[model samples]
Target: MTSARDIVPISARLLERLEALGTPRDRVLAHAGLAATTALSTEQFFAFWRAVEEVSPRRDLGLVVGAEASERGYSVASAAALHAADLAGALHTLARYKRLTCPEVVELEVARGEAHVRFHWVLATSEVPRLLVDSTFASFTSLARRGTAGAVAPLRIELARAAGDAALLRERLGCPVAFGAPVDRITFAERALAARFVTADAEAFSRVVPGLEAELVGRSRTRSLRDEVRLVIARKMSSGARPSVDQVARGMHVSARTLQRRLGEERTSYQEQLDAVRRTSARRLLANTDLDPIDIAFLLGFEEPNSFVRAFRGWERTTPTRWRARVARG
Candidate 1:
């Protein structure tokens, strides 16, 4: 499985919303068990949501925060979109820059007289939580409502999970909400995209583009050696072969000794990284797929199903079958 970089930025909008509600950013991070202030991994992002749930008094935490963020949306993270000529341009800008924030894919397509927005958390091992989903959809609608003239509302909303607290969504979004769908989507009026952004400043937006582009390029060019090694290992494992340090290093144009030294500087060894990858990949396969332990063993390049089970027991303290069953029950 492909994993994301530490891509999810600690968004100002989320922190500011909590602060406005009289909660400190530090407090939330503390409650979330997160020490990193710069960005969150995809898993850590979920922990952040759990923190918001624990600290906030409002039952509609996601709705309030996401909507309010739209009211004063401009931030260094979104300087380009703040001055886009129209809603379409602003959304396009945000979409372009989303890689700097999170692993999720934000798709905005206007088709058949409707504007459809979809999100794909492609690398996630499990379900995206309801609160995160709500906040995301709410942010988009609120942005539209903030930017456009007169009353604006989504035509329809669809969610994949149970409808707990969905009435709050209807009240906040002013639309019919449907749940238990295969995918989540929000449908808006098509003309809304063409509506001019009330905040647009073309000149300012143009200036920020080059700097943001440079930052994005820098991110692409400087991916972590650990992540690169992980990907190479995954590819080799999927091809039914175990990749050694030497083979992995050769692929990256480095000597095995040099790779070991570099990884040591990163505070890890090749075997350590390999075990970490196997642990994560094993759990992900167990949780997300119906593949049996034997088949999964093949994919992980294990010599035998029993060997895979032994390693999984060491990592998770349960048989793969039991773990899968427990996850299913949840």
Candidate 2:
């Protein structure tokens, strides 16, 4: 139902939930008439939800899955929101990261004493499934409650879908529900934006923001030669070894000569790419984590502490420890 170029990554959690609930993944895939793949496309995602509706007995499955999501470990995207200063910051982070990782857009607007949150799907040609709408709103309400200590509630909910059982949604969400609206939205008192998240952690948010920024840049285009090589080098580093050109080429399914030629065309080479990544990553680790230089050295695939120190000194014109201290002083 999708081209190889379309790598949509939505609702794997829902798929996993369905599998856990005795609906076999193979059966679901078979029902959707989709091929086994690492990720789903937009069409496949809708099909997956339809499959869930057909197989699962629970009529309100979306709310159940979405409401339970935040209680577990926070996703990288959600982790950003959880560590935000307040409800407004969290919503902003959520919207920013969602746009980075998916075609879905979540926006926040405050005017006339109401803070309005809305969702728009770039790829949706048909009506978004009711299950998904329910799940998304439930997830938002649940996230708000968890972050704000249940201090805020939605004033009203507006769905773009054709009219449904408004009373049922209102009862579950504890808010007035209206259907056939211009956009799928939730309204809250504008003052609710200032409610502090009990879970907020400034340091954690700072640490995650860099990675999210990198993702935001990377997601805007297809992976370049440098990015692909970086991926290989990172994987090799994780295994506690430096990656070689031949190995990197192998990882990328290209011959060494071909990889070199391509890099030349791009005006960069593998070693330069590796050095840039290590410098950036070393700083991030030093600034964010409690890992010692020796540990960070190994994590970055340096053979020994001396090697990492020499490299860091070359990059910063100072020792890693002093650089970290100076950064801390600031």
Candidate 3:
């Protein structure tokens, strides 16, 4: 799993909205372990939300916040969307550049005279928070309306959790809302796909998108072969499956022999990559979270807690409990 420290910061607009509602920016930043000038982690954002819920008595808090937030609050991703020529293009831009803001997954699927735009939390557990679900969809709707000057609205909204007050939901979302759906999604008429964006600037878009793509590529290039392998390993571990060398090779679109040869050039092997990531992850979890060793072991894809203990001893020269105690001391 991607650690909180590594996830991209929440959108600037959402941050601004929170502060406008009397949530102190400094307090939120301090609680999230973020500097005022830097982007914050999703974990920090969640903490901020919890604080907002506690202090604010507004029953329509999510609606108020979402109604006020739009693409302009999204920073670079907003820029990409504003410059795109049409509604569909704008959404495509958002889907591509949104990771620059947050790690949530956005998928655009067009079929059967409607477009299904889905939002999913990458770091979510089984219980998805109501605040997160509401804020995300509300912001999405606001952005779309802003881009097209209210020329489009969703045909329907599908939420994974139970529906709240129907009248209030309709008032906030401007659409019929359905609850207990399999996914969090918005459906729009096919005609909306071709609707020209009121903010479209073809020239600006042409100028900005390439630079963004170049910067993204440059960042990716900075990662070593070892780093990529570690990332693949971490992802597999998060999904409760330990990936094999052959599987990783295929995932990377390389032959196993070629992948091994490349690793050899860096004086490492697949096993070394796995071990290093597991050790680093185990240490991070032990230090930062309250998860037991057995839970951490399962999260790291170890079949048994005993095996994890044995490996932890080899890596740190101490048991997990002792290692955690030393970490606490320091």
Compare the candidates by TM-score and give the number of the best one. Answer: 1
Clash totals, every prediction: 0, 0, 0
- Candidate 1 per-residue lDDT, tens place, 1-330, comes to 124465566666667767888667788789988786565677778777777777877778778766766556523444466577777887788777766666555667677899887765534545666677888788777776765544466899987665577778899988999875545789888987788877787788778888889888877775678776776675566445778888889888999999999999999899877777687767666665556688888777777799888988988899999998998798
Question: Which 10 residues in a row give candidate 3 its minimum summed lDDT?
Answer: 120-129
Of 1 and 3, which scores higher on TM-score? Answer: 1
Sort the predicted structures by lDDT, highest score first.
2, 1, 3
Candidate 2 lDDT by residue in tens digits, 153-215:
899998755566677788778789876554468999999999999989999899889988997
Each prediction's RMSD to truth: 7.8, 20.6, 8.4
User: Which segments of candidate 1 are over 4 A away from where they belong?
Assistant: 1-4, 20-27, 72-79, 222-330
Q: Against the true structure, candidate 3 has what lDDT?
A: 0.72
TM-score of each: 0.64, 0.63, 0.62
Candidate 3's TM-score: 0.62
lDDT tens digits, residues 1-330, model 3? 334323555655666766777766677556545555344445555665665666555667777776665544555775678677788888888877765556555777778888888764443322334666677678778777877889989899987554566788788899999875534679999889898888888888888888888866655544468756765665576446766888788878899899999999999999888887788668766765566899888888788899999999999999999998898799
| Overall lDDT per candidate, in order of appearance | 0.73, 0.75, 0.72
- In model 2, which runs have C-alpha deviations exceeding 4 angstroms? 1-6, 10-13, 73-75, 222-330
TM-score between candidate 1 and the true structure:
0.64
> Model 1, 198: alpha-carbon shift in Å?
2.5
